[model samples]
Target chain A: MSTSTSTSLTAPTASRVAGTAVLLGLTLAPFLLGPYAVATLSRILVFALLALSVNLLTGLTGLPTLGQSAYFGVGAYTAAVVAKNLTDIGPLQLLIAAGVSALVAVPTGWLAVRARGVVFLMLTLAIGEIVYSAAVNWKPVTGGTDGISGVPPVVPLPGTPALELDGLVYFYVLAVFLLLLGAVTRLGSTPFVLALRGIRDNEPRMKAIGYPTRRYALTVYCGAAALAGAAGSLWVSVQRFVSPGDAGFEIAALALLAVVIGGTGSMWGACAAAALIWLTRDYLGNLEAVAGRGPLLLGLLFVIAVYTLPRGLAGVRLPHQPSRKRTA
Target chain B: MAGWLDGNLVSVVDGIAFGLLLFTIAVGLSLVFGMMDVLNLAHGTLYLAGAYTAYALSDGTVPGLLLALAAGALVGALGGAALTLLTQPLARRGHLDQAVLTLGITFIVADLLAAAFGGEVLPTDPPASLRGTVDLLGHTYPVYRLVFIAVAAALALLVHLVFERSSLGALVRATVADRDMVRAQGVDIRKVLYGVFAFGAALAAVGGVLGAPILGPGPGVDESVLVLSLVVVVVGGLGSVRGALAGALLIGQVQTLGVALLPQYAPFLLFGTMLLVLVVRPHGLVPSAVRT
Candidate 1:
């Protein structure tokens, strides 16, 4: 999955410095941008997390899925339920949401992971649809198509004051986003991830090496579901409303599209692509002339991205990563 | 049990008709996927297009219905050809890329269709001669549905014979088994690929035309039909005619009866049935002998 084509002999120190600069810029972006842009950035961060979740299974484990949004919706609904009925503590809500989503993923993911390729894809798609249908039909529990609203403002911690302003909420989202981003980065370098990469590249070979590939896939599936659930919790926090649409196929498709456009295994690229896609949908679609044409534009973007960015945005060579030989 | 059967008799008949429609659509999908290893997510779009064609052309007459069917098949074939051209380049890239490309096509076509037909469900009427209800065992049933069932069953038999019993079927199966070997034997594999894709897509479109009176054409119809056909393909087994038939009929019953019996959980029944089937037989109810 980590098809790093660059074999450059550049100074590592320079790349480290550039990474620090980029992080610094992101940390200061909310303050520098307008309130509208800051809100959009927060949305981008939530979707970026979802895209990262998709990347874990799709990019890392080679299990293409269309069902992450089910977990996302589950997480969002759980958070909304907690906020309305139990507590407004953001951290607690996020934790419970992620935990529940992971739990739900177990049975579904087990069924899904048993198959490979298109069969797996079909199972996940069915799973997503079922979840969506449940959300719509289970009116007493899920509030039907209307969904749950009137979610209170999120408190970052147990004792901290609630985040009332958009700017403050953006900071709260960023904090959790960075913490999870760090966890995922650490995960990328783990032996488990290495095994997943092995499975992705050649499952039969990995099996011959005595690797329990299905177990790895299931574990990653649950982990990715947890990540998506956390993102869903944040989405509820940001929107203060959870609807069936939150868990619909469009959300799943867009998140996966973000992963594909960003480059499957590249985490940073996913975030960037998520931001670009969000902007295109949120900002460009609202333009006077193009109003209500968001889907059409998104469809065009998908076609163009697949044809032009076959290797994805992250696959582009950076200053330090000079290309040697390209893998066919 | 007799009382229950009497109560649910119409639903059972409806289920068979619905299943036959699904078979018409899904059989093509099973064949194309088995042979080409291409997962055309846009298969439902062809169905939508055919439904729209019926909506536009049918004037409640037998001749008009025939015209709609012909037009629907033609449109489906053209669409299949177009998709083949779009997907051929990605043959080496694997199913994920193919899924993405076809999904994109689906989105674009669905949008265009929405624009042309509006976003409402457009229901077509059966021909005047077929609009009346007829006596079934003890109750009356729609003549159109009964006719549709007969037509669809004939179609199923024709497809089964063509794919399972004919020399062309042998050639197609041979191509699927080993394209290189078939090419070495002086058969044009590309033509076969294109033909299979076109025929499969055309069949789906024809089903759509016939099914429009029952399911109707709406904004999200393509998505729903696509999911159902995917379910049919999975439960019936991937690439075989018998599998599609078995899967479609089973699902059709589940769908119609599940709704009648437990309206609240009908949606779950579709996926639940799929889950059970996969758990029991992962390859499907009737898996194709040749594995991809």
Candidate 2:
């Protein structure tokens, strides 16, 4: 739990410049990228959102989780059901999905917050596996692994036309991704997040200082679950389908890996690592040589990443960390 | 209620067999964690490897099963030793790194196993002698399951004796309690670490070899086994053999009997059970005395 060192809020101007530059590139990507690339980027954006949610807990809040995908799956299924029966409005689906996911997180998060370290990870994993089971066995609602399909195209607004084109959907995803990114960035600086970092750093000390660490852990857990749910909604909007696999262990694992590989406590790092991982899993995995060896290659990436990128891919500290020959 | 109880007596018996199987796998996981503070996520891969050994070596004979068990144990020990070597570097990196690193190993091994054995769950049958049915309290039961229960119970007793009553177990527990203290006594603490890890891994693999017929070995089976063992260890209190048995049996009942009674809520039953345990006994029903 105290594995990663803390990342301070430095390089504010450089980071802002990089953020704007990345946003500009993303805004112009639909024109430069092919439909498939655009669609993949959309998926990456959504996954990045999920990874950010994971980072909220692991990187910022100090609780490592392998269960965020449970919330993601809940959101995806909720959005699918809402789109199929209620409305095709993208924002509404996102809202309802996030809300339902947080609601589902209440009891689950409460139980999860009762423990820390490996115990917490184990609890969350059980929560995820149980939800995955529900998706597979609850045939009436979850459609029993075949999953809910035939989702209507996501409408961005009340009167706006549905987003059918990959580029259009990509834009919508990017917009939401950027919005959440800003929110999380703002959240990182808040006193509440400082308290969370304190809890992560030393929970006993925080408790000694009169902080309700358990309540904070639970609150952040629900918030992260809600964020994961929103990402799932974006996923539904992008794919126009929902499946049990969306909420499976792989999704949760990948999100956790993204946070870890991106440099814990760094939102930008999480997004970059999420993008890289998705690209690896989706793009490289489907190659002819390793056509169905997606898991194998991803596994290799995990091993290699763990060894070679110990500080993570986005672990750039221009002013603080100098290059080193050995671990100090 | 009487009708349900009478009808599900078979389920209760079956739960015993299943729980015993889990204990065989989970006890190793529990002790390794209890002693080493290392959470090897690839622990389930040992079970899968053993199952595949059963699938590969089964010749409808007792010798074949014994051979498979021996081979599986060797494979598991080698796997554990190798894991110890790989994970040793990350010892100071904290458990998150250890967990993620071992998880990487799990993914790699699971993928490799899936590649070699194909994607489908491989069904392994018991030896000719253990095959077929037997009458148990007016209910027809598989002979192999009854045999499994007996063997697994003996295995559990052996484990309990070795870990709780034996001098080696005392050393392992002492190491867990205070590594510096154990090393100060001139004991090669790393040897104990490797020994415990390899022994636990071997036990898990042996369970796989034995439980192949019950749980089967497949692509995702490794993950499922890992999760189940994790739950068992958590419920039984981490690193405690007694706790693993208690938790495994309870879960086995919930899995088998609960499913038989309410298929719709079987999965939730597992979660709800865990939730209740966490709420009522956060350290588990039987927590390890020298906590990590």
lDDT of 1 by residue, B154-189 (tens): 999998888889999989988878888999999888
Candidate 2: which pairs clash?
Answer: none
TM-score of 1: 0.93
Predictions in order: lDDT: 0.88, 0.88
Off by over 4 Å in 1: A1-25, A32-34, A318-328, B288-292
Alpha-carbon shift of residue B98 in model 1 (angstroms): 1.0
Kept native contacts, as fractions per model, are: 0.47, 0.47
For model 2, the DockQ equals: 0.41
